[model samples]
Target: MNGTEEIGCCGAYCGTCREYLKTCKGCKPGYLDGSRDQSRAKCRMKKCCLTRGHITCGDCGEYESCETIQSFLSHPGYKYGKYRQALEFIRAHGHAAFLNAAKHWTNAYGRYPEQDP
Candidate 1:
């Protein structure tokens, strides 16, 4: 299987999730065609880790006690269990864990990830 098949426990594709794509863009060291506005997916993990000096959620100093992470989890419509599962999976299996658990948070509770307007 090509890299895309390496599924994440969160039901995400490690190879194509916007965060990974952002990492790819980081490699190129330039703004992707329209990433400045488009392609800015609303994943807290990606946003926090990329913009807030965290390499991974598990690496955060607050870890099990982080308010940002906990607040996100408290939102029932957001599927806290699944998100935590993904985080736990990442802690255990690294990025590969997201493959199985990468279920989209965007679709939960009839909510699609909101795009910046």
Candidate 2:
């Protein structure tokens, strides 16, 4: 089920997406210009955050814990919070599961304008 192309807006790998490849009959990754390497098997969201040692957007010290997450939330193609879902889904199903739901801890009891968690 490994893949190179994607259809799901949250950057879910469509090559592994049973539904898209089945329905469309054809599709592939965009940047086929580069050679495929073992390390190439990485998630876009996870890689970016990990570069800062923040595995997820929630781990960031920024006031907008959900800033990067929001831009994803506001994507024109995504109907649901699929990007958020991806974060959650991976934990339960592991790397192979790209269709995961995102879970975050918002300041409900605390006052607004939270700078850190």
Highest TM-score against the true fold, candidate: 1
Name the 10 consecutive residues with the lowest summed lDDT in model 1: 25-34
Best by lDDT: 1
Q: RMSD for each model, in Å, please?
A: 10.9, 11.4
Model 2 TM-score on a 0 to 1 scale: 0.32
Candidate 1 residue lDDT tens string, 29-49: 122233454236455554564
Where does model 2 exceed 4 Å of error?
4-9, 16-66, 74-78, 99-117
Using all chains and alpha carbons, the TM-scores for the candidates as numbered come to: 0.44, 0.32
Against the true structure, candidate 1 reaches a TM-score of 0.44
